[model samples]
Target chain A: MEGVLSGAIGVLAASGIWLVLRPRTFQVIVGLCLLSYAVNLFIFATGRLVLGAPPIMPRGGFIDPTAYADPLPQALVLTAIVISFATTALFLVVLIASRGLTGTDHVDAQEREP
Target chain B: MTPGPEHLIIAPILIPFFAGALMLIYDERQRSAKLAISLGAVMAMLLVGVELLMRSKGSALTGFNDIGFYLLGDRGAPFGIVLVIDRLSAMMLVLTALLALPALIYAAAGWHRQGQHFHSLFQFLLMGLNGAFLTGDLFNLFVFFEVLLAASYGLLLHGGGQLRVRGGLHYIAINLTGSLLFLVGVSMVYAASGTLNMAHLSLMVPMLPEPQRVMLHAGAAIMGLAFLIKAGIWPLSFWLPTAYMAGAAPVAAMFAIMTKVGVYVLLRLALLIFGAGAGASAGFGAEVLIAGGMATVVFGFLGVLASQGLGRMAAHLVLVSSGTVLAATGFVLAGGPVQILAAALFYLLSSTLATSALFLLIEPMGREEGGIAALLALTADAYGLDEREENRQPEVGLAIPGSLTVLGICFAACLIVLAGLPPLSGFIGKLGLLQALVASGSATGPMAWIFVAILILSGFATLTGLVRVGIQTFWASDGAPPRVLALELAPVVGLIGLLVFLTIKADVTLGYMNDTADALLRPSIYAQGVLGAPRAEDASP
Candidate 1:
């Protein structure tokens, strides 16, 4: 589980950074979402992965570090996901406005020389 | 020492929040009601700031949360979200009110009517700033960062233009990237230590094993990058000047303190977690700060000289202020005397006020008022009469339009303050820093000498820039005087008056700042306050 998750994290971050550097505004916004997802997953992984164990505490509450996944990181990641959603929506709005006003889809709102 | 009333600590954050959301019911055309709400909220914020500042000093640190500063209401730092108020934060709160009052007042004069939702955005921005200053945990800090950024976005776009929208896009993208880095950094710290409570993190950080310590250090470096970018350090500072230039004058004025927020957080964390107590990690990033700070100062100097526009000049001054504070703090962490910290705080207060005043002054002076066109017509007439060198009139008897005298006085005062000349608070602040640096008996050291050199050069550079602009706009320009409104001019004068007051009462103000710095340097009181030490009495019910 750890192996697959870490591998996916690397790929996602790489692709996200790759797209973020592109000239087009739409691509940049999409890249931002991908990057945020990658960050969210990375934060989730920090709590340590444990399958088949409830994150909620047992009544007595003295589990070993390796027992259950840490719930705090999961909660933090949830908040992050929500914030990114809002920001992504904001970015899309800005994208349309800029394209309309400047008459270009480029991030700089100007066409590049061939 | 018992914690003061709960309302004092949280009101600054809460009043603006609810007031802003409440304002939504009012129609855009109902300007009077919205203005009343914003004014009432800002006035209440100033009162709360004064009350908090009075209570913060000499008071034992107390919080209810184990995870944050909200521990006093049965929610200690380990689990509850805490809101903290120490001398540093309280000073910051008061400073925010000081800047916001003028900026908001100036906006009400005319800028607010330019766009939709100005009052709401301004108030929410206040809430976010106050919350960020008071918050104790890493996660909530992130939340406040987003809050302020969101409000600022709307505010920047309030007076819509193509340039403003373009600026909004760049500012948003850069901050979002910074936020991602902040989250990664916070997670790394949490992964290394089990808690997000600041004091706890401080306690746990030094004891981590070698490998985990490396990871924590990396996290800190990345987090520091986000802050430095926000603080307008060189190379990372490119977005800053444009944002200020493109933003409306009032928004730009309020933003004078936003960079300082970055500096404030860095200062707090450096002292708490990575001070002399941190053993191997002591002064981890101080050298980087000093070098980067020096570069930023030079960049600002050149930018000031290159600027043809008043707003652009004001933007570079912001960079210069940040560079000075950054370098000053870097001195202390790099093993200079702790007195330098007090000096830095003094400088921080004066420079923020002066820069905000300068930005406000820009709005009144930059208005074209048909002055240049009128002057051009005069020149044509004069040429028609006779062709000769130096035939232009100093004053065309154009009845030097409305409020030019008052505006000129305010502009001169801001220039004096920014240029770090004597008989003003700016000079006093710089003197304090220099005295502290030299008195440490390290005058012979290269670092101290280099710092002094940059300090003197930056002041000269600023003086040159301001004087040239003042002459061009106020004296040389033949345009009709821009009609300065009382609402706008009054705030600028009021801010400059506060600086004069600070100058005359330097002893008392410097003493207070000295004590604040002493408190910050010694973190034991802070730890005890938050942890609610067993031997001490409970701060409150």
Candidate 2:
């Protein structure tokens, strides 16, 4: 499971970097979304890949040290997801605005003469 | 439980947050109400800042050694979020309030009306900056950083022109990538240490085994990259000048402090987590920081010379200021005296104030074409007219208009400060920094001398560039003086006056800064202050 998850993250990040470096604004926005997804997954996986374990302790009971999954990374991933989502929305609006204002979808907001 | 004065640590964040949210309810046409609320919020923040500064100073004087920790939801450390206030954070809070008040006043003059929700966005930006300065959790820091960046995006695109849109696009793209890197670094650190609380992490970091130690260092280095990018170090700062030049005057002025936020975080974390006590991770990225900072200074010097517009020149000066402080931070990390860091802090304050005043002054300085036309007119007046006509015209001496006199004086003051010339805070900052650097016998290697050379050379470059622009704008111009509003003029004068005040109180301010630096170098005290605080259940009646 760890191998598969790490491999998937690597692939997503690789493709995201490629797309982010492309000239088109649409590609760049899409790339950011992909990169954010990879980051979210990476953050989630930081909790050490526990399965069938509670994320929090049951009230007033003897607790085994390793019986529960680490919950902090999960919480962190949630925050990252929300922030990345909002930023992506903002970036898309900016992309459209630049496209309309400058009459181009290039990352520079203008096309090269070539 | 009812809140008390102890809760004032969170007021800097909460006041702006509530004010911004409240302003959202008011209609855009109700500009007066929004303006009043924004001003009131800033004033309240300034009061809170002064109170916090006093309390921190009192703590230092009484030898209490307590770094004020305001635990959120009354939870103890390593679990809940915390807002930690020391002399350094208190000073930063006050500085932000000071900068924000003038910028807010200037924006209210006319720039605030240029776009929708300017007041609310401005308030939110303050909240984010304050939160970033005050937070004790790494994740909270990231959240606040995003908050500021989001508000900045809105503010940057506020008075949208084609240039602003293009500039805003690049700024958003680069920062978004930087945010991703920040997340990656943060999560990596969490994975290795199992704690995200800064004080907790500091404790855990020193005890990590070999494998996790490498991961921690890697995560730290990546995080440092994100900050260095924001701080406008060389190669990563190409987008800064353009983006800053593209914003409205007041917005750009406010941005003069944003880069310092990056420097502030670097100093805090480098000393807290990677200081002399961090075992293998001590002084992790000092060499890279020094080399990069020196390069940034050289880059800024060249850019300042190459820039034709006053706005662009001001933007490059921001880089020069950031580089100098950044290099000084490296020196401190590499076992130099803490006094060097304190001097850099002084320089940071003076440079930020000067650059901000310069940004506010740019719009009133008038356009480049106007200067050219004025030069043409002056040449025509000099030679085109008959000798008798020329002699009859100025025998009464050039009657400098009141506005022109003010602008010229302010321009010259900015020049004196930025160029590290005498009789201003800028020169004092540089002198103190150089003295500390040279006087530190232990760390005065060849690199230190090279940094000193860069500092002096950069100051010379600033003098040349600013003097050239000053001559073109003032000495050669023949156009009618640009219209200056009292609201706009007051802030520039106030900022310059503050610099003058800093110069006069140099000894006192330097004394405070030295104490702040001494505390910063001792992270163990900070860790204990946060981690040793009693839980709500234990403390409450």
Candidate 3:
């Protein structure tokens, strides 16, 4: 499970970086989304990849720490997701604005000569 | 649990927040009301900031060593988000408020009305700046950074044009990437240490084993990269001049302080978590910071010389200021005297104020005629003038308009300050920095000498560039004096006036800055203040 999760994050990040480096604004926007997803998963994995464990403690009991997953990473991941989502939307709007204003979808807002 | 003076620490963040939300309800036509509310909110924040500054300074006077900690939701520190107000944070809050007032006033002239939701976005930007200065949690700092960046994006695109759109696109994309790096760095730190509170992290960082320490260092370096991007260090700062030049005048003026936010965080964290106290990790990135900072200063100087427009010149000056402070921070972290840090703080204050005034002055100065055409004509006039014509009129009094005279004086003051010439705050700041750098005896290594050389060289370059621009704008041009309004002129004059005040009161301000620097260098008080504060419920009888 750890191997799979780490590998998934690595792949996502790699592809995201590739797309983000592309010239098209659309590619950059999509790349940002993928990068954010990879980051979100990476943040989630910080809790040590526990399975079948509650994130909360039972009341009035001597709790074994390993019986529960760390909840802070979960909370952090949620916040990251929301922030990244909003920022991606903002990036898309800016992409469209740039495209309309400059008559190009290139990240530089200029087209290459054929 | 009753409210006390300590509660005022949170007011800086709350005032603008509520004001922003309130202004959102008003439509675009209700400009006057929104303006009034925005102005009121900024004034309130300034008052709160001053109050906090006084309290923090007073605590130092009484030798109490009390750093005000405002725990959210009555929770204890390290477990919940916290706002800690030390002398440094308090001073930053006040500086932000001071800069915001003039920018807000200048924006109200016509810039704010150029786009929708201007007032609300301005307020939100203030909230973010104040929050970032006051927050004690690492994650909370990131949140506030996003808040400010989001608001800044709106403001940058406020007066939408092709230039602004293009510039804003790059700015947003770069900052978005910086934000992602910030998240990754922050999460890695949290994972390694199991804590995100700055004080808690400071404690845990020193005790981490070899592997964890390496991870922590990597995370810190990554985070530093994020800040360096915002602070406009050399290579990372390629987008700054364009983006800033593309924004409306007041927006650019407000951005003068934005770079300082990065410097502030670097100084704060470098001293707090990785100070001499942090075993094995002490002075982790100091060398890199010094090298980068010096290179940035050189780059900024070159940029200043190359820039044709006053707006771009002001943006480059921002980079120069950031570089100087960052380099000085490296000096302090590398075991130089705390007085060097004090000098850097003073430089930070003076340079930020001067650059902001310069930005505000650019629009009014350029209001005479067609922008590029007029500039081209001025250049031709300067270069193509006949020798007999130049010698024709006596070098004495020509009938200069009163408005032009006022603008000229303000422009001269900015020139003097940015160039670090005598009789202004900038010279005093540089003098202090140079003095401290030289006086630090054994610590005056090659890096210190390099920093000193760069500082002096950058100042010279700035002087030449600004003088050329000023001559062309004021003397060579034959256009009518720009119709400067009182509202617009007030902010520029006010900022220049404050710079003058900073010069006259240099000793007192330097004394306060020294004290603030002292507090920063010693992290024990900060750690105790944040972690030792009792929760409200616990404090209650």
Candidate 1 regions exceeding 4 Å error are A61-65, B1-4, B59-69, B369-402, B441-444, B533-541
For model 3, how does the per-residue alpha-carbon lDDT over A1-114 read when each residue is reduced to its tens digit?
Answer: 999999999999999999999999999988888899899999899888988999988789688998899999999999989888997899888888888767899998898888
lDDT of each residue in B1-541, candidate 2, tens digit only: 6777889999999999999999999988788899899999999999999999888876535464448889888787889999999888898899999899889888876667566799999999999999999999899999999999999999998766677788999999999999999999999999888888999998897899999999998888888889998999998999999999988888999999999999999999988998989888898888987898899999999999999989899999999999999999998988889989999999999999999999999977874355323423433332332322432342122223587789889999999999999999999999999999889865648888888889999999999999999999898999777656677778899999999999999998998889888888989888988998787678877
Candidate 1, residue B197: how far the Cα is off, in Å: 1.0
The candidates, ranked best first by DockQ, are: 2, 3, 1
Q: What is candidate 1's lDDT per residue for B149-237, written digit by digit as tens?
A: 88888887666656767787888888888888898999988888778877777777778898888988888888888889889999899
The TM-score obtained for chain B of candidate 1 when compared with the true chain B: 0.90
CA lDDT scores, all candidates in order: 0.81, 0.88, 0.88
Kindly list the interface RMSD, in angstroms, of each predicted candidate in the order they appear: 0.8, 0.6, 0.7
lDDT of 3: 0.88
Tell me how candidate 1 scores on lDDT: 0.81
Quote the lDDT for B182 in model 1.
Answer: 92
On a 0 to 100 scale, what is the lDDT of residue A52 in model 1? Answer: 85
Give the runs in model 2 whose Cα sits over 4 Å from its true position: B59-65, B367-401
